[model samples]
Target: MVASVPHDRVRRPEATACAAAAILAGFSLACGPAAAQQATSQVQLDEIVVEGAGGKGVAPAYAGGQVATGARLGVLGDTDTGKAPFSVTSYTEQFVRDRQARTASEALALDPSVRATQGTNAPFDSLYIRGFPFNEGTSGEFAFDGVYGVAPSFRVFSDYAERIEVLKGPSAAMTGVAPNGGIGGVVNVVPKRAGGDLTRYTVNYGSNARFGGQLDLARRFGANREWGVRFVTSLNDGRTAVDHQKEQAGVGALALDYQGERFRAWAYGVVQTDRFNAPSRPFFMAAGVPVPKAPDGRRNVTQPWEYSDVDDRGGLLRMEYDLTDRVTVFGSAGGSHTGVERYFASAPTVTSAFGTTSTAPQFYGLGVDRQTYEGGIRAKFETGFIRHAVTLQLSRYVEETSREFAAARGSYVSNLYNPVGVPAIAPLRIGSRPRLSDSTLTGLSAADVLSALDDRILLTVGLRRQTIKAHNYLSNVGTFASAYDKSATTPFAGLVVKPWEHVSFYGNYVEGLSRGDIAPATATNAGEILAPYVAKQIEAGVKLDVNGFGGSLAAFQITRPVGELSPARRFSESGEQRVRGLEFTTFGQVTPQLRLLGGATLLDGELTRAAAAANIGHTPIGVPRVQLNLGAEWDLPWIKGLTLNAAVIHTGKQFVDAANTQSLPDWTRLDLGLRYATDIAGRKTTFRANVVNATDAKYWAGAASFGTFTLGAPRTYLVSMSMDL
Candidate 1:
């Protein structure tokens, strides 16, 4: 069950003079003539003729062209009103296009608090925000076009998006149950749809031997402008710098929209497929031995047969109706199906000096098939003194996983004891290897956003209830088994104050709960199941709109109880973890020709309690302390239709294990882009070139286990051309 808070009824006077002044300031910067004329008139100076200006102009005339837009920073729209509160950061489409970002990870690099790992493995390439790992297995909340889509594995293409939004902290009221909710934040991808023009087409190529294109076409009809259709498609193929690795992908989408006086409808569908080669898992060498490197000084250990493949399909339908002038009703439903298959080599053996070797049997095959369905509805209305918005959502998710492998049933193998001089022996073929697991999540939630105090202050609150059911079909015959059922309620709250038209201050609190399903140690009775895990968060931030310059700053804290896992007992509750951090970002146009955008973040994460004496008070895995991003674009007036841009990313050292026994070093990378746009045969065309890791810096991006590290990519270049018709 869920409840919504009542709206507050109050009124306040508007800021008349302040609004006028702000508008005037904006006009002066946007149009120089008006500002100059006002200045000259005040000075009582004679009318002065200006070049490129009409008679009686006071200021010199200059070519007026489109100004570059900067990134969007500040709070997120889906923030909870009362519980687990936090700030949000957004990057607009204009920023992404100006930077010419090639991937989602690259697009997020504009934020100072976000650290990205660009390893060869697709599953490992992820983002760490405010000391939280937000990636595939441990995904935070994610939304598509402002709608909640609760699937961990969502395939997105940068070419099809208009912008990306990063919401900091827990937001269970807006989002829902997830694997890890305490530490990380949510990222929402906003798609591009019909606007203005009726049709457009673009094609691009990369120097890495990859080519792709997209087509967007729209049509308008009817007297009331009630019908529209949009279509998009893309494809690409390329090889990575890693040894023997290749990647291929294809994507397509279609959308239809209908608009009437009181009713609106939207239908959309998408399909994506990817095939790629997998890289080797990293490992450490013995003490005093030289670290082995590939022919080019990079780590190389990938097996020739390792590979990964994925297929995804999804669709959505949404409808809205304006019941009256101040009342509206809206509903949305969506579904997705995903399939994955992978074959990878595993290095389960390690060497120690104390005459002991540790090893586990290597597995070569794993597969997963997942299906999800989500639906929601909401109504909004405004009264004499209060505005009210309410939302109700229901979701159902299901996932099935299968694993097959051959195991060794003998003593641990040692590097020196290999009589055949091979590091790993061939795995014997077993009669049959089978393992299967299934999980289902059902949830319901209701929320409201209220405007009170004469619209000067806003209040939002919500509650959510969820049930998780799990079953392990192969529990009686393998090392993995689980069966569990549980339920929990999450609450959220937030407050926003608009002291002035250009400034807003907000704070939030939110909570999240996830069911704990334990793995079986033996092929026997049902595995032990523990209570649901809960995470809490709090955050406060401020947003400033200074005419054309926008900026935001926020501070947050998150806490969660730790659950330990082992082969004997599965989970032992013993520790508490907390993450605290601050994030700041600035965007918008600094000048007409030169645009600058950047952000920075500082965070500290620690474990307050642990079973191991040395593990207590240590930093968690993959959390960095300091992250920074800086980007600038210059439009060269001397060279018509030419622009130059540069971006830099810096990340501090990070721990790789929960105990903080091992760590990855700090790293920095630079990227550059050049673009030229002109009219050819009466059509708009653009030529672009990009250089990533321009300095060819060799650095470690991530680590899987003790002493195992993944290297970043070397310098790479991409050249592309696009034409609009």
Candidate 2:
């Protein structure tokens, strides 16, 4: 029997000094703002291996140890990439530290199929995967530990993450409906767990005097080592690469678990806060204006007094029991809350070729609360010549949002190139935020994998019935404005055929779900709720693995529905957007001391149907035609435990408007790094250094599907050291 345990307990960290002091008390590390800015400093500890109902502990790394051999696939549990029909990749904790990634977006930049749509200094993070928006709407699309609503809402730090997994294409049948209706892919974060007795300390420094420190501790108790606990805390504060911008962040996380012969349980909690002065914002293009050249990457037009602050809290509990050798049951409950307060100019609109811009400053406050519950059963058995693996999952997700806003006294004008900063405006008073919207999603899914012929052939089938219910209320008064409830069923079918020991052919047909649209007041069917829209994808691929080298080539097509108004002024889901793409990825050790990781994606997107005839056949906004990334690492034969690496990222031109009248030019960036591993005073230690945008190219990084664009980050340096005790 499994033992009962209380859920996670999380608290907001105090100021930088207090929080650093508290976390550094028992450790032998230094504290304070300047501690990390020194010439030497030490980083995060590795997690202990503990398997839940998922069948195994963390997946093993490939030859180079930068990427994992497999990743979690929602209700399907942990799956090897070579055996799974879908395309997925998981970056290991080693990769995160080697790159010195401060956030999820930084670590994800290496993927050719994904692109960041916001600036590095933006208040929140947003991404586009496979030519579609992932986290662009009111609700986030990230999942923590195979469940939604348990990770930070706005941004995710890598301090407490064991691995970051990306599953390509729509996954409604595999993972359930995404809160934001994202059809591109799913990004999952695996939290760190206790592993081995360890105490580790890390310190880092970034360009412009940014300093940070982290502490990690883990211990296992009991005679059988069934009880484990791990805790991690970190803080970063100082000026940033951008002009007039200062950022501060603090994070604390705790994880506990109990591993028994037949029962297992895990609990996780995390709290984080981020503060920014003169945070960067996206840019918009005025209608009929020609796109202008990008300004210097360090340019900033916001007043120094403008600021933003965000706080996030999350907790999760999971338990599993094995009824028999062939059967297991599992359940999990988790929740997260995000709070935001900011006073700054919204997206600035460029009005002329000379870079003249206009924006209105405002004060905004927002709150989002999310909760998720899931339970599932897995069974494995054989009948005759076929071996079957079956699973059934039931899940529910709920989200609530509230907001308050007030505009400044007047608008401000600035030049993107010259960056004229105006005097700080008086603060706009905002009242208590009222209920804005609430949504509930419920789903039941089942899948079965049938294998025969010594596991050479595998066929999988699955289905999910998903229900979406949402309510919108007027701000302040909290009076109901509108409501909708709808349900739909999505299906999945996949096949994998292995002809040789190291080669496989795979294909899949899957469907995705999105909330239906509400007719506008001008439509004939005003206020009517349409049926939930369904997206379909057909994919086929080939995989190869031999002698520590591996790669995959895949081709797929996705078609999504869009709302449109007919000639009769009746609104309905009658339009469509279609995208066809090809992907090629390679990862592993090419030689004894050389490693390669990168790929390229080719996309062709078109608006198949539209409300306006003039828009037919136009390319979708923000869908680049070509994207490429190539990275390599070489271990110096002359020096032991030393490696050098370099990478290049390039994106093709993209349209900024649905009408195709505005566009942003293509851009390319280069990155370089080096690291050394050695023992310091009998303790294992590593030192790393990196240069981002090494050429200091000034360009437009990317465009949002909504027609906004982000400025590229300037050249910057990063360095860090980690030591284990």
Query: CA lDDT of each candidate?
Result: 0.58, 0.86
State candidate 2's TM-score. Answer: 0.92
Q: Top lDDT: which candidate number? A: 2
Q: How big is the positional error of residue 30 in model 1, measured in Å on the Cα after superposition? A: 34
> How close to the true structure is residue 123 of candidate 1, measured as C-alpha lDDT?
36
List, residue by residue over 1-725, the lDDT tens digit for candidate 2.
Answer: 12111111111222223222323343224644554333123222133232221123678678887788899888789998888989999998788889998888889888989999988888788898998888886647888998999899878999888889999998999999988889899999988887544677899999888999999887656645577888999999999999989999999999999988999999999999999999999889999997899998999877788899999999999999999999999999999999999998778889999999987778888999999999999999999999999999999999999988776767789999988878778877757898988999999999998999988999989999999999988765578989989999999999999999999999999998989888988999988888888999999999989999999999999999989888789999878989999999989999989999999999999999988778889999899999999999999999998999999999999999888998888999999999998888867788999999999999999988789999999998999998876
lDDT by residue (tens digit), candidate 1, 504-614 = 788878876666645345422236676777778888888776756766788888887766653343356556778888888876667777766777888788988776657
Candidate 1 segments exceeding 4 Å error: 1-86, 118-125, 138-142, 146-155, 179-183, 198-200, 278-299, 346-377, 381-384, 403-435, 475-480, 517-526, 565-570, 703-709
TM-scores of all candidate predictions against the true structure: 0.78, 0.92
**Candidate 2 wrong stretches, greater than 4 Å:** 1-56, 521-524, 564-570
